[model samples]
Target: MPEQPAGSRPTLEAVAARAGVSRATASRVVNGGAGVRQPLADKVREAVEELGYVPNQAARSLVTRQSGAVAVIIAEPEFRVFSDPFFEQQVRGISRELTANDSQLVLLWVEGPGDHDRIARYLGGGHVDGALAFSLHHDDGLPALIRDSRVPAVFGGRPGSGSGSGAAVPYVDCDNRGGARSAVRHLAGLGRERIAHIAGPRDQTSAADRADGYRDVLFDADPALTVQGGFTVDSGARAMAELLDRRPDLDAVFAANDLMAAGALRVLRERGRRVPEDVALVGFDDVAGVAEAADPPLTTVRQDIEGMGRLMVRLLMRVLSGRDGREAGAPASVIMPTELVRRASA
Candidate 1:
């Protein structure tokens, strides 16, 4: 074989000649080798290796009509995006799945409602094949925008009842309502009445469902026992303080997430409330470095956050591949189960 000059790159034609196959055959092998015989594919692979040839992604995408990339849109503040371990774990799972499928992951952060227009424009520009959206509030307009743009998307949680008329999108979420019920039942089984709840943002479906779970067990309980939180440590602390003031005789508390539970624990200790003694505590998400490290160790509800993230990717891929004919009806969603992790806090 003649050696090519320095600074010259190998092309499909060159690879085809070396492999003793037509350029179309070589192209088919390089582009996933579909419909090509194994022996021919092997020959093309050998030629590509010998010539050190790389397919031009841009040119290939034009032919396949696939960008070979997926977008991960986080509709939250920068602080929450970075500070929450939940998001980090979910992203890790998504990244792994996308890598396995030979796709690129593009992360887009939406700071507030004002950024929705820009995000809609980006999705409509055909820059990615699909998207996985997270941390969406009930009132968020981004979901409808995504629908209108015709970008296949999978949400990380059950979307809230938005004001728009867009059809329901597929989502992957933990069993928030069931988990909350389990927490409340455990406290009830322990004979702890007057159980109070510190709920996350009301607009989020997870928080709303969790609050619903709390009520499932305490339907007849006082409405004042429930307080709203922002799913942050500070918000948890403030909510707990208010709960104490509203119902000082409360015997137990179930925080929506572990971060809030941790905050509640701090106030409980400061106010001389003994965990599992005077006021049993339970949190959700079982986040590492938070729940287990709490003062008395929190007995919380555990959800497979990473698994949820991976499921989101898998669902989006199905939509992109049109494997299940997703558009015939409502997009399918997956609800992962949760369990109660017992500890000293409860």
Candidate 2:
């Protein structure tokens, strides 16, 4: 490398020379690798500060063949993932675990059509240590991409898109159907009949599973209830609005997520209806913003979003360490539990 004039950035060689160590040692120290002694490590640290050295991630990735990083891919709009409390909580959990393990987290937002192809290329090219995929839909073709990559991957939920019962890679998921059932059953217990459901996207396992739970319990309870919604607030609002138009006597609504439930409430309020008095509403995901900010508060099904993120990281670490529980003849699906939070909505 060419020597620079005064005030230029320091290279790895400069740090190595200043620390009286090899360039490789300087690189390792900068990347946070273990095994360097305190004296040498201290020298490298001091030299790094004195020289204002910064390690190039791409160069380091080439040397280690491990980026010291992982990617979290969500198949949804950036706003949806960024705005939702669930994503924020999960990201915090994921970051906590990754930072503890000395790894970095990279987030990839895949919302546009044909973007999965680009993502597949990126992952397949060995850009990340592994990948964590979430919110897959039926026609998304994401599973096939990950399957073809041969890189280690962990899904957030069971894939509702494919016929395959089990995953080639391990997955962590919440008990969606059970949670939905609990929410709907609670509404029934409140003596609210003519219930309508604002469901999640049909392709997502959480959405389908939750919708199924609501449908099964509602049919068993009243046999006249129905469901609709695609897990968005707009979907919830539209579904709620339509249900009200069709069945003016509908007394209850179950939304697939808090955002959707919030939408349903807005639509209800707009049409001059009272919540819990005119129509009881329930939502899943117990997201903080919508759950707490609703007109009369929201009754929602809650999952440990942060725990899920941490658990996913743990599973990936196991894979990287070659001690994966499922691969070691343990149970495959690690299903996390859910809770129903009571509020004024239902």
Native-referenced Cα lDDT, model 1: 0.89
TM-score per candidate: 0.82, 0.81
Model 2 CA lDDT for position 328:
58
The alpha-carbon root-mean-square deviation between model 2 and the true structure, to one decimal in Å, is: 4.7
Off by over 4 Å in 2: 1-64, 163-167, 220-227, 323-331
Worst 10 residues of 1 by lDDT: 322-331
What is candidate 2's CA lDDT for residue 248? 85
lDDT of each: 0.89, 0.82
> lDDT, candidate 1, residue 236?
92
Compared with the true structure, model 2 gives a TM-score of: 0.81
Query: Which is the leading candidate under lDDT?
Result: 1
